[model samples]
Target: MELNLKRQIGIFCVLLILPALCSAAFTKSRATFYSTSDGLGTPTGRCGYGDYGRTVHGGSVAGVSNLWRDGVGCGLCYQVRCTNPSLCNSNGAYLVVTDYGAGDRTDFIMSPAAFSSLGVNSTANDELRKLGTVDIEYQRISCSYPGQNIVIKIKESSTNPGYLSIVLFNVGGTCDVIAIQLSQSGSNTWVSLQRVDGAVFQISNPPSGTLRFRFQVNCGSGLEWRLPKNDIPANWRAGATYDTGIQF
Candidate 1:
C-alpha cells in the first residue's frame, strides 16, 4: 500500500512540472544592430521588401544569415526581448525579417533604429551605441499581427493565353504554403495551381474573368480570398506584373 501511495506522489509531481515546461516558448539567441555603417547601399532586401523603418513600429527590420532560406524568410515577424531583465521591456519589441546577412552568424541583426527601440540604454551622445550587442530571447509570431498578409501578383502572357505566372509576397506564419487553387467566378469547379519556384506559381490555360484563390497552408488549414473584375488595377497589362495586395 505504501509503494502505491509513493507512485501516486511521483505522478502528481510530474503533472505539476509538465505544464511549466510546456509553456516555455522563447528561444535564446545573440543579437546585434547595423545601419549605414554596414554599407547596405540599397535599402531593398533580396526578398524585394524595403521601407521597413517606416513601419508602424518604427525600425522594425532584422536580418538573418543563410539560415534565412533566401527570400523565404521575408515578412516573417518575431518578438525579441533582452535576456537582461533590466534592459528588457515587459512586452518586448517586434521585428520583421526584411533582409539577409552576408556572414554566417547565428545572431539576429537588427536595424540600428530597431535596436534603439528595444529599451536599451541610450545616452545623449550615443543612442544604443553603448549596448552594441545583447543576449536576447526571441520567438516567431504571425505577420498578421502587423496587418500584413500574403499577397499575390498575377502576370499574364499576351501571346500565350494558356500560360499564367503569379508571384507571392509577404509569405510568413506558422505554416508555409503547400498548395494553391483557383476558381472562376460563378463556377463551382476548382483547378490546381503549380509552383514555378519558391516565390512563384503558375497555371496553364487558366479560366478568364474574375477569380478567387484558395491557399493551403502546411498547418492543415487554408485561406481563401477573391478579386473582383472591377478591383483589377488600371495599370494591369498582359505580360506585365501587377501587385494585388490580397491578404490571407
Candidate 2:
C-alpha cells in the first residue's frame, strides 16, 4: 500500500510540472529577414491576410517554413531573439506569422522591423542586418489584440449559394484553429470546411440559412471546440466582414 501511494504521488507531481516545461520550451533555429521599402511585411502575403498583414503586432511579422503547418500555423505568435551576444539584445521581438517562406536552414523569415528589433542598438542593428541570417531561439506565445474580436472576412472568391470562403482575423490566443466546421442555423448537422490556404477556409454548396461556426483549437491544453457568439447572415455578401464577437 505504501509503495502504491508513493508512486501515485510521484505521478501527480510529474503532471504538474509537465505543462510548465512544455510552455517554457524554446526551439533553436536560423532566421532571416525580408526587406521592404517601408520596413514592413507585405500586404499580399501567402497567408491571405491582405493589408492586415502589415499591421499585425505593429508590423512585426514573419514568414515561417515548417512552422506553417500547412496554413494552420497562420496567426500564431512567437517570441524570437538572436543568439549573437555581440549584436543582439536580450529582450528580442514578438512577431506574428503572416506568410510562408523558408531560408537557407532558416525557420523564420521576419520583416525588417522585426529583425532589426533583435539588435541591442542602432549600430548593432545595422551590423545584424548585414549578416542577413542569424542563429536564434524562438518560442510560441499568446497573441493579444486589445478590444478586437475575431472577425470573419468573406473572401472575394466566394459566391452566394455555390461556394463560400473566409479568412479569420484577430485570432488572439495561444491556440491554433486546427479544424473548422459549420452548421446552418437551427440545424444539428455540421459540415467540415477545408483549409485551402493559410488562414483561409472554404466549402462548396454551403447551407442556405444563417451559419454557425465552431473551431477546433489546440492551445497546449488538449484541443477544444470554440463557438462564436454570432453567425453569418443568410445574405452574407462577398468582401463583407462578420464579427464573431469572440476571441481565441
- What would the TM-score be for candidate 2 when compared with the true structure? 0.89
Model 2 misplaced stretches (Cα beyond 4 Å): 1-24
TM-score of each: 0.58, 0.89
lDDT of 1: 0.55
Cα lDDT of model 2 by residue, 161-181, tens digit: 899999999873657899899
Q: What is the C-alpha local distance difference test score of each model? A: 0.55, 0.84
Error of 2 at 207 (Å): 0.3
lDDT (tens digit, per residue) of candidate 1 on 1-248? 00122232234347763232224478887777776654232245554443332342344667776437644565566677777666665455666666676433445787765566567455421533466777777765555423434555564433244666665655654455666777766677989887654445678777666666666655324553344232333333454543345443
Residue runs of model 1 more than 4 Å from their true location after superposition: 1-22, 36-43, 50-57, 102-104, 124-131, 145-150, 154-173, 178-212, 220-235, 238-248
